[model samples]
Target chain A: MPRLINRHPGRGPALMLGLVPFIVLIFAYLLGSHVRLAANPDDKLLPTPSTLMSTLHTYAAEEDVRSGQVLFWVDTMASLERILIALVLSASIGLAFGLAIGALPVVRAALAPFVAVVSMIPPLAILPILFIVLGLGEVAKIALMTLGIAPVIVRDLALRAAELPSEQLIKAQTLGASSWQLVTRVILPQMWPRLIDSLRLSMGCAWLFLIAAEAIASTEGLGYRIFLVRRYLAMDVILPYVAWITLLAFLMDWALKILRSRAFPWTDMSR
Target chain B: MARVTVKGLWKRYGDTVVLENINLDFADHEFVTIVGASGCGKTTFLRILLGMEQPSKGRLLIDGEPVSPEPGPDRGIVFQRYSLFPHLTVLGNLILGLELRRSRVLGKLFGARRREAIVRAESILEAVGLAGARDRYPAQLSGGMQQRLSIAQSVIGEPRILLLDEPFGALDPGITADMHKLILDLWAANAMTIFMVTHDLKEGFELGTRLLVFDKLRHDPQAPEAYGAKVTYDIPLRRLKNDRERQRLAIVEASGSEPSYAPAG
Candidate 1:
């Protein structure tokens, strides 16, 4: 038999092992829910799977009497729109600021310290300020998410750009590359995968900011729905909504990973 | 082809002097190899010639005109590593120089011009023995193949002068022999004046028509930065051809008693 340290599972066995924790957690939750429902038939803290499924069916299939639209789909769409817009805005701001600050010494001198300080400020602390300045609208929510993550992306990409080997830049210059050409031809191509990676990392923060802003002010969103239903002890609705959000986040992260590998195959070998 | 002339060149970073009072002249199509100890400013000299660096005092002239402070396509360089852009395939790396030279804004070409660039790139890739790997990224290549692509990337522009900074220092000894042959063939075919800085004295002597040795003449124990290196021995090896014993003696004498040549930075 192999020693414990040396013993390693094959790919098939390793994937099987990865599912063990999820299976155990689900089994434990089902047992707890059964016990709770047996003790109190009207218990709402841990709803049985049937109750949860029925609630999901009602929210997803039935339109609200007044809204004339399905609340579940409406909430998901509103949340997706806000997060996607915020992500695009943050990525553009990050890429443009990061490359300028990293590639040009003058830009670094002028803005690096300011960016450093900005990144240090707690983004959530200024929620009220943002709401007041940008008003209680979609702009405020998007601004909150963008402000939360753009500085981090800028700092990460700046470090990456600055860490690029000086030899490559010199070689580009010797090939008749001007300043703009150097950035566009040499530095910019290498930063795309890294930018994707930064976006992947910032996804969680973006969702947090999105939910916080929506919980505070929005009329419709996944976060708003969850928060609105919390007063009634609606575990049946909240639990499924939380799971759905997690699945959506997982799919997004997985998509980005696939995009990175397919678009920038060279980065895999670099690691 | 380019004639390079250096007159009283000095490079000092504040209080620390890196190179002091260097003077040399090179005719067109000459292959000069520079060997020195670590931190002796051989790479700095090459950078100056390539116009990536400017001398603190004195002038570097090419064909009787002062070389521009900014690096230009007139000169090409291949470092030991990180010379090829990793994001680009081998052919993409070769075509980039031409595209950058031709199209200033987009740094890209189209139609017939793009086809012409590809043809030029393919031919150079063929010359460098990388025709099979033209579609592969630099990271996918072996060390020796990457170095070949680097050399190809530099030479594709057909610059008048080629600067090599220890281009083979990272390769295996067995692989370096093949590289030496490739570089010699490229040098002869391109007819560009070349200045190569190498840590290996034997490789320098074997490759260069002219050999330069950079060493410091004076040193102060209290202040190590008080002095800088100069070209101590400038030997024309073409005259010493067919004399193996003389070449061996010259290598021994140039290295001196300690011969502790560190890798060039």
Candidate 2:
């Protein structure tokens, strides 16, 4: 009779429970850094919290030597721009292709196999090809990210569109919706939240591609900075940059979840 | 309001026949209820009437013109499920019909027309007893409420015909009874014709002005799919007063021609 173990924990307790793992991770990293740096002051593998803090301050606060801008803000902006552009392109393209594939048999038959083949070819493997074809610019980098994630998005959305109950389509038609109206109203509205969900899922892949592209060839970006300082084994910069990326990804995902719940509250119940 | 005429209709999928030799005339403002056993083509007939399905042979005419094969504003349908768009609220669902028909862009009703649509939708929602649940999503509603919302959504379009395919099949008896009253009231208020498919004999009898039974009169054990269901019995239930009288009409089996009707003695 221990109050049924409080099946639903209070909000404060739940928040604390979520933070426990992060706190443990931070403490473990701090302990490791302490033990390692105590023995070797110049150990580049696990930098001390002081070393990381100084690097963070420099990146975030100080101006760059050449550009007269904060390198951290510049890098963050560059990476974010690519990620956002690539996501918008993929989302629009994926939604269009997915809706076509789902609603039309001919489109599904013709494009499905091509999509499957493209999805199977790893996006990273074709990074050089993208650079070769599109050239080593923002276009190539964005293309790499889009290529990496769009096919999977298309495939997922197509499946979802196909799985949509025929009754809804029929009902819409009976309600005076033309084919175009049906697609825009009935199909598109239903897929909007799912598209956001697909994009949210693809964010991780988007980051991987962005980093890979930036690391290989870029003037300034989060990924480029991480790779740029890696020559001297700048673990302080590398670890914080990685953590920042993780934080950004988590925030984007959380925002999408909130948006989905607020905008399409019926989504969870129907599925 | 529309007159529906089915002439020498036959539906086949591959070699199997689903419905054959279906001929009937549905007058304007008629409350026609179709009842049959499972897979007996009652739903198919309703689908044909809604222009969702095509007969392999013959034709369906609405007001003397061949009804288009594609579903349109002329016919509105309510299925057992997926009747209302889950994403839209009850009020949104009700106004959607007018918005889609009137607005240049779908789901973007605005200005004076939007205000008019809202006013119209609210009145219909009130009529269907869903005034309080206007902003609630269809999923938030009970089965009965969802069906009511769906009916409101359909009727808001002012379609020539409203087709219901076992709309109350999922509801309990009390809710079903309430739905029956609501539907009849809607029918009384609107000028649109109604065609409802149901498995419940009592429901068909109680709600319908005219009753049509679909049954495979010529059963073949060797070639079960050879013969399809037809209009085995067509009864005018407006004259009948009691359950016993309706049951008497229900028992009359089909001859080759459409069954002749007489007032209950």
Candidate 3:
């Protein structure tokens, strides 16, 4: 662990750099809520950070909170679950597609036209069609999110794989690498950086869809929480959740970037 | 321990004849090198011997049997560019050929201990002077180190015919000399059959037991008296039999024509 740390001391600065956005977002949200609440001094029942924090403390103090609500933590949990599932789906699908496209030019040529056409459509534009077919449920959210983000994943992975030096494969073949051996041992590891970048982008896209999907169809999720609170003008409650979501996204992106540098120390060609 | 016979080998790129009637024979454990000016088809010859390229006409036989067009364990090849798998550590790339070639159905379930493979790989890495650098990925190594890795990776596999395509063509003189010594020592140690393609004539003379010079016949057509290229030069390892004979042969080789070629400094 110490040696690994020695290898990448830049991670400390990188993490700090990654934190800039989250800190700014949190500060802006808190400042906005304070000003809004200051102007609405008459409404004690309206959402504010202090009120929501106290309510949160009370809810924790009570041993039980209702499972469904516009502003409870359940939707946040579901959104997280949806994002996690989307990550796995996008990665596997993307990697497999990437390997195929990278190894064979025909596959890339055949799929490129469709990929360009698919990525151009907005994530929200397809949501209604998905809802019409799958109904306003988890299925619609997953389908929309997967369709919205899978192309980037595939594109990045395939591009990375394609750029791999042809000599590497020739070496592997001479080294007695079988078809499967070459893919797993050579092709897969080389494509990780792009895969990591794709994952980060996919997570952001998935999160984006989580909010929009809930806004349209679902009764639960962070998007619904924001919408429900806005009806009653609950800026305080929204700030903390927004802070949590922003902080989580920042952390995930940082963690992946760290992993990318650490895991692929050999790929310092751009260095 | 292997002999290669390339007979009337003809390779064409679409319609351009890259090699025509390339008849050559490499005796057992002989270090045979082919040198040619750019586009004279020296690399194509090496590839054909290694079974990386197929002759549009003619046959390449190892011992008495025709060689496969596809690369196989019987032949080993090192590219001019160090082509070791970047993701793998030095030892990983070295033993990859072994691992991929190891019997899998029952070998993994019931073969030699994993530690033995590691130990052997370490020794091979040491032989290649890459012992300390075994754990380092290929990308972390210098160009010279990567070249050494490529050699180690090929040598450990114990292939019958080791094919090299200008392995040190891009190296500085000092590094090239060191690699030349390292490779010669390894070749002597195993008495391995080596086929190297080079554009550097002196390096060819220093490293190979036989030199197959390409006869590239280019002429100023106005002078219709242009001669066919100097076709071949045998290394005359007559030097190995006795120092005096070796000197005599070197003098003869240095001054001869038709097949006589000068070594580049």
Report residue B194 deviation for candidate 3 (angstroms). Answer: 1.2
Q: After superposition, how far is residue B73 of candidate 3 from its true place, in Å?
A: 1.6
Which candidate number has the best DockQ?
Answer: 1
In order of appearance, the predictions have TM-scores of 0.94, 0.89, 0.79
Residue-level lDDT of model 3, residues A133-211, one tens digit each, is: 9998888888888888887888788788878877677777776766677777778877877788889877777788888
Selected candidate, larger DockQ, 2 vs 3: 2
Model 2 TM-score relative to the real fold: 0.89
**Model 1, stretches more than 4 Å misplaced?**
A1-5, B242-265
Q: Against the native chain B, what TM-score does each candidate's chain B reach?
A: 0.90, 0.89, 0.82
Model 2 ranges off by over 4 Å: A1-8, A64-69, A104-106, A265-271, B104-108, B241-265
Instruction: Give the DockQ (2 decimals) of all models.
Output: 0.52, 0.40, 0.35
Q: Count the backbone clashes (under 3 Å) in each candidate.
A: 0, 0, 0
Worst 10 residues of 1 chain A by lDDT: A262-271
lDDT of 2 by residue, A1-271 (tens): 4577667878999899999999999999889888998999878899878888999999999997888999999999999999999999999889999999988889999999999999998988999998899998999999999999999999999999998888888888888887778778888889999999899989989999999999998998999999999999889899999999999999999999999998887887753
Residue-wise C-alpha lDDT for candidate 1, range A135-231, written one tens digit per residue: 9999999999999999999999999999999999999998999999999999999999999999999999999999999999999999999999999
TM-score rank order: 1, 2, 3
DockQ score, prediction 1: 0.52
